[model samples]
Target: MPKGVYLRRAGRFAWLAFAGALLATPVYAQKRTATPQKAVQQQPAALTIPSDPDDAFVALREAARKNDADRAAAISATLVDYPIPSYVEYFRIKSQMFDSSGQPLIDTPDAEISAFLQRYQGEAIADRMRNDWLLVLGKKRDWANFDVQYPQFVLKDDTQVECYALLSRALKGQNVAADARAMLVDPRYYGDGCVDLISYMAQSQQIQRGDVAFQARQALEQNYTTLAGKIAAALPDARVDGDSLATVVKMARNDPSQAAAYMGTISGNLSRDEQGAAWGVIGQFAAKKLMPEAAGYYRRQMDLGGNQWLSDESQEWRVRAALRQGDWKQVRQSIESMRPELRAKDPAWTYWYARALKADGRGSDAQQQFQSIAGQFNFYGQLASEELGNRITIPTRTTVSDAEAMAMRSRAGFTRAKKFYDLNLRFEGNREWNWELRGMNDRDLLAAAEYARKIELLDRTVNTSDRTKAEHDFTQRFPMPYRDIMQRATDDVGLDMAWAYGLIRQESRFIMNARSSAGAHGLMQVMPATAKYVARKIGMTDFSPSMMGDPNINIMLGTNYMSMVLTDLDSSWTLASAGYNAGPGRPKAWRTSLSRPVEGAIFAETIPFTETRNYVKNVLSNATYYAALMSGRPQSLKDRLGMVAPSAVTTTSLP
Candidate 1:
């Protein structure tokens, strides 16, 4: 095609494609044309500007993301009549406020930001802008204005903001040490807020010296050497050496035993808390490596300085090490030592603690623990239910009246969210939608999910329905779109349809054109290399990576690949699910490391990679629920997992 003709066709195609997405039953039901098109296509006949307002809006957003204030303003000027004007205005204003790295541009007046917030009050974008401005105000130490705006910032999800908020409180002579310790668990997001908080807290003597050492341990564990050094400098005695901390972190990565040995040599010169922190780091690395000595290292840490200085994450690692070593006593003790609130937050810890109780012959106590988590719908929840002799079943489906569903169509948030979704701006769309879901009752959630389904926002439909506490619509939550295509694909490969659906639900939430950060694409999140490999295996001579965007082609290739992994892993769902996620080699190597047959749940929990461990558990749990929904029979997650035995002969390679 000629350049002029191609551009016109692309512009028209982009609008028509978005239009089809709005009206289609499932957004991906409409197939794309063979050729790829640019998001912001311009027709030659329309001078240098984009032919469509939405295309110009897309360009404005790209400019804003780059913090190109001039370009954003120029493009946004052409989008005066754009369908989503709030976002267009938001980008124009935001571009002027922050540089490309998201640092606030110096001398940007706070009045301009407050004006936007005042105009768009109670909207998601306004709340988001408040979050941005609070960071700026916090950095500038403009606590007077920050104090006024902090409570109005609705989401409060940003950790750095929380840090700054705590810092502001501490400045007012309030004790915020406990709050800082709780919120500063993750150093990756510490930024200026957390780093400043720690410094101020230490200088004021509000937090104990042990707290500073713990912060250093957390930073070193995350490989934040500079942050760790800063934390060490906050200690009054300067007893914890920054260079020694760096050496221990490096040694832990390569060899946990070496890290332990180095810690042992330095133990006498260090404070008890520092000694414990060093030992905790070694234990965490060793636990991740599945080393049997991990439990002993944790015990040594506890023996030296008690568990008072250990972070919640370090305490969790202590439990994991015990679970790996099958040391029930250590598991029980470590869990009991955790802060009550932290221990109760994660059901995985509860489940393991219950298992330890049962292993220690405290059956009634274990039963009580199991009952606490049993009727829930997550991975640990299902496992707890099976332990209580119950199978997973679909909750009774809830109904939404037509009037109730119709009401969502008039909601301002939903309307804006739909507009963003139509423009393919999912981040903004999700924020708008989720912000509306706060404090909603079960019936309201069901109605909102119904509205989502009617609008072909199937992912939103699933997520919205999944939030209901007392009522549910299983059909809405586990939406089966393109059933005929999915059915045929699974049948052709002799794959279990429910299992395929389960994996797809976890993989992409049925978003047909979904693409992961690692470059996995389509409904199945098939990697490009894996798609080609499956294409060849299944005799798809004309297959290309672009073809993977098709729901039919993607599902077929994904299910075929699923079948291959299952066959390679001896048809174990647990192993195959892990293999599908982390790769065949990892699960294979994990299985070989097992000394004897263990329950599949143990194998999943013991998996070293956090992503793969959670993926396997969720895939199996989803498969159980999908099976129950399809078969109209209570399904056993335990039976589905079965036993994962040691296998010396395991596949080490696959696409």
Candidate 2:
């Protein structure tokens, strides 16, 4: 979700409010039959219908949003000459696609949906209709129809849809266990479709009991007790039951030592995988708590059964625990013990593994690992560059010609995407935009990014430009909008303008009225309380949270807060960036918990909160690129990161 999407949604709701009076007396506004008055009014005339087609369409849009099929039908009936007949028809069709519970209406004919898909074949809504229909088909076990339509789902980003697709293939005697395993890591997204896939695969012997057990561990780790119970029931063996697994997982979460003891009591009755999984769970919780015993638990986990039973998460936590203890050998061993696919997927492991190699006098091997990831542009990639004795610099800019950019403006997909963006339907707009970029060459991508910038969609500009392989455009990727306002704010507090802009880019993608779900507002994503606190600190007694919507005010308050956080955290940009995202209290506590001085990358890796970890990495990496752009010189990400040392005393004075 975009930061400040709620603020944008508020604007969308304003349109809904405009038609609220008509909606108040909706044609289907009758209450339950238990109310005598409602029963009498059930057959009332359509007196509330608007004469204007636009107003009628808006009413229909609102009805569709509420999933009021009867009202939508009543309103859409009056939009006979609506300019956007596609949308008018779409709202009507969508209202009937699913019932109030969001399940596909079994009575809705597939022919009607197929007709809509054929009518608006390449449009975003048509694809959305197909997605809705596919779910209905999947639920009904109509794999024949699902197979015919699944290829047309343009985004294919929905996990449930992917699960269904995999399930469809599995029903046809195809081996999809590996693919299903990869997709089923996050139990939170495992709807009935994924659950069905796992159950079927388990029953048919396509997937071993270990696979189901692994999923059960994953479910328990996420506190999805019911899901864990369901998955555990799929295990063929009686020893691996839900109640026993949940008890150990719950114990591990609170006290790893207790869980370790509990595991010892049952070791004789459990399989090797079961024992390793329990130890892995204990180690994960212990490591996250920064417990000193975490390393030993991880060691025991490995000793029990090595990497085969360890989840990717467990292996990563093992590396984290080893890093915290400064055990280079353990770090190397833990990383090397990771599944080959997992090791290759994350560069953090590769970078740390390289460091471990260097620490052990394996210089040539370490150099190879660093060289493999150095050319990429990311947190680890930049660190690897520095390890290889190279400074971070911008790749040569790839210019998109005016003619190429203009050509993109005329493309149907781009136009439709722009329309959706204008309507604040960002999800649809982004899908529409990306759908057209699949086969584009590097030059074409640059052109689309430039066109995205022209449309003032800075987020799209950054994301699209970031996709290029052979060509690059830093300006588009790291745009500096509201430069004068941001510069003035930064200068007022002796702050780094590049760093402030980088934070804003990450915070809001330069969206002026961006708002986060946490109630942060504007380009800075400054929370209401933080804005007020900054307002008082700056002696702006008259300030209100609404002022955060203004770029100037948001930047002023945000920069001041950033400055305060930096000062409180000993002027360390790494700590300050972390403080900015997760609040000052967390980084302060994290620093105070450290046993010794650690490299900035290691400190970032060990951050307990996943969001803040990634946030700090991206913000600093962004700052490096911004610094390069502003200074017209090579910049060092390592210099920005510095070294994070333990603090004997910590304070949470900054909010």
Candidate 3:
């Protein structure tokens, strides 16, 4: 979800007035529906042999919307002789993905599917069509087709396709045990396909008796108690009954250690694995609470062998609590016990490990670790650079030659992506651009991004630049496209331009027309109601809905409100960011219990709303990076965070 997405949801009903008080909204190409498509009335009996392409296109969409496949197909047939836009092709493909009866349209000729893919090679809708086609193929047990198409699946984030791939592999007598373990741990992604894969693996001896309990522990640690119970029920050798699991869960809710002690009552009867799993779940409860006794609770159970999942989580939160209490020694010990593979990738734990090393008089070793992760982008990565006694620095920009730029621009995918942008179809444009970069090396990616910059596609340029790993181009990464507008907004509101930039980057990735699913509008994702209120408050004349996506209007209104919240929260950017995201009411309530000033970092970690906590971190961290880019000097994240103090009571909900 985009930042402030939920905030704008309720305000979507606000009337959007176009030019001269005309209430109009653009109609988007939605996914196919089950209802039958409806045809338009004939233009005139004699005049209408067939409407022109544009007129035919409108009728086609209506037919598609009505789920009248036959009529839509007829209209789409007329489009064959006309020069239709890419979206017309998209609707044609979508209508074929699913029929009006709500069943996936399988048995379509493979040649036709292949032809569509070839025609829309670089379009976002192409991948969507291919995904649906692959699903149909997989269902029909056409392994040869599935195998050929699976590799071309650019965004392989689809768990069902992954599961189907595994199934295909297993049927071909391939070993997918390692892949299954990595992919199946998260219950959230499980669907009909993944579940079937799991069931097949279980029956095939790939899932052992021990693996069952391990999965149960994995489920429990993630707070999916029902999934955990299901795992336990399925395990043939489990000693613990359903009733005991319930009793233990209730106990764990109060104090994790208490739950651990209760496990002792059945210690003699339960297996070692069961004991470990129960203890692991208990530790999760304790670590999450960050109770004073959390460290001891995990420390005493260090030798327990349980689900590898729970062990990792238990250690992570133990370190989190230890860090909060300034217990460097315990933090080091907890991280040291973590799996090497997990520890190697986690920057947070690595940073803490370096801190522990420094505290223990091993500055040389700490510096070595810090040096490896420095210059990277992310919360912990920046912190690591600070520990190594260096500040964030922008990378030198590379010039793109005319020949190289032409070569990049000539690519079919990039051209299609650019076309989408020009048509104001940003969503489709972004998808197409991202898909085209799937196989490009870092240098190629940089070149493509430079080409995007040359074309003034600032949003795509920024996003494309983010894909580079071997190179860092801060100019492209933290672009200041609407510099003049932002300057005025910040200057008038007396707020930090870098901070505003940071918020906008996270809010909409600098897309001028970005609209979230929750109905947030424009670059800053301002709610309609909030925009209206701010418009009136600032005494702006002729405020209208047509101005939502206008970069100047959005930045001015957003920055002004930012200043308002900053002042309301006693100049705390941390709280202001949270207020901006989750609303000012929650932050005010969250601050009421602050008996004394607390570190912004600690308060952020403890924020009950996961989205707001993450939003605050991202905004502040981004601001830090932007500050480095703008000032050409190091900036302190600590100074930016400052200390958050309790708020004074105010009559108004939002300032």
Candidate 4:
């Protein structure tokens, strides 16, 4: 075959090969006329092969296979003319390269691979190609970089596990045993396999055989219980001996109240390790809900100094039980007894300690404790602040008479209902539309009515189908102070006022004292540590966690943090919203690594988290409606708040 002709032939063959078969196909011919006068001659109709791009590619494949260079070239040319469907483009590109005999090219240059990845960025094909490149690179150090950079790309198979294991071993050099154990515990590799693998390997003394038992033990402690029972069942038998059995019996006896029944039933003939495991099972059971039983076993294990390894685990269980039962005094004592190093590193402990202090009426001390944390404040601070009588404040933009507010509310109400009507029209066939409307009817109608009342208080008139009833309901539930705070914060942060209201609504449902499980506090759910940092930056001295409960402080800090996150994330509200819900660092990293700019809608849809995705939609939609209500003008919330440009004011001082 001619050198250049092979390329064309290869391209065509790729287009034709499909569904496990290579078939010969006839090529459509274009007719030509010698002159315009002679061109009156009739031509054959164009062959209407399947219009799908995949069919076109298959046709191209058949032509290349037959070494029909002209047909292949024509097909390749044709394929390029159509839209490259996301799925088949990879196969199409590969089929384009050919060797001298018109065979598909075997090896492609790294640069070509990189270029291909860039061209098809965000597609699954790009991920596969990138993984292949990383494997080819085969540098141990690069594996982590590759994993972190392309988490969505890595192949999840045995090969992936082995590759990570090898990389871990190589990185650890002299401590391959530890590395292997670590790899097995890593969520990416071991997943549910870690629990059984650790138990089995430990019983067999595999780490001891490799002179890395200590390191292996560390890995086992962190991940063993995370494995599922199904995977654990497949583990190798645990070695049990007489001495181990005796130790287990003794451990069981130490927590007599909890494990006494289990101890009585265990076979006396069992070896020491078997008894130990039996006791472990008893401990596990107690940990679930029978804390008394678990505590007994843990105490026995603690007394047996030889099993000091279980000390930390026992204490953790005890602490958990105490917290579960809301034993504030016990929680305080347990946290105080814990090593300062551990308490400092674990946010949970710190938060609980602060909570305990607050519950004990040491409010001042609790506030100080909450204030000390920088990044790790969680729900504890929120609870502490609320108990201390702190309420977030929203500053009013302008004083308006009740009549003015009522008039504004009427106008906004008309716009909102109409928008919903229009949206229903646009998405008449969409189930999601129906779902949204249903949800609005179930709950948001009341919230919207309340918002309308606030607008009405500002002398706004909202004309709608059920204006009288809505007005009555709104008047009953509307809180002027809260609405004022939301409006002021929105203006201060240069955010759309409606967006701020929407965020507050979704975050805390307008409950000034609401606290989330993740430690977000107040109406705006400002994290305590975040609040402290903002407070310090704003030159507020003697700042206390109690202040976070204050409406003004909460709004100020939450808005400031929102502004900071928005600035850091390229001003994209979608990413900023993600950061707000899931922390700023993760979304920022995701945004930086994305090869293609995500469309706002598609980005929200593709968000890996269900909570964050819904949050973005709710926040944006709420903002849109709020803006319509507040401004008395129909405008897109996304356009106004989607990407904020930095203001001329660079200082921390509030406007």
Best by TM-score: 1
Clashing pairs in 1: none
Q: Provide the overall lDDT of each model, using Cα atoms, as 2-decimal numbers.
A: 0.81, 0.81, 0.69, 0.46
In model 4, the runs with Cα more than 4 Å from the true position are 1-168, 176-206, 209-260, 263-281, 290-292, 295-318, 326-347, 356-368, 372-378, 387-389, 392-655
- lDDT accuracy of residue 343 in candidate 3: 83
Q: How far is candidate 1 from the true structure (C-alpha RMSD, Å)?
A: 12.8
Worst lDDT run of 10 residues, candidate 1, spans 25-34
TM-score for each model: 0.90, 0.88, 0.77, 0.34
For candidate 3, what's the RMSD? 11.7
Better of 2 and 3 by lDDT: 2
Comparing 1 and 2 by TM-score, which wins?
1
lDDT, candidate 3, 439-512, per-residue tens: 88777777787788788877777788888887667777788878998998899878999999999888988777
Give residue 611's lDDT in candidate 2 (0 to 100). 90
Q: Write the per-residue lDDT of candidate 4 for residues 1-655, one digit (tens) a residue.
A: 1224212333422312320111121111112214553233222222333466556656755554553333445456657654333223444444334332333332434456667877866544565555544433332123444444445553444444344444433333323445454344233344312332333233334444222222232223333332322233222332223233333434443453435565665647653433444444345335533343454554443333223123243345545545444457866866776645456765556666887898899988887776664222122332233334542111122233555333433442244333433333222112112222232341233433444455332111111112232222322222234667766876877865565665775676555566778777887898778788888877889889888888988888888788877776667777677778877765654443233443354344334455985787667655554554555555443353343222233222211
The TM-score of candidate 3 is 0.77
Q: What is candidate 1's TM-score against the reference?
A: 0.90
- Give the per-residue lDDT of model 2 (tens digit) for 405-522: 8789988778877876776667767877887788899999999999888879999899999999989999999999888988888999999998998888888888776778889888
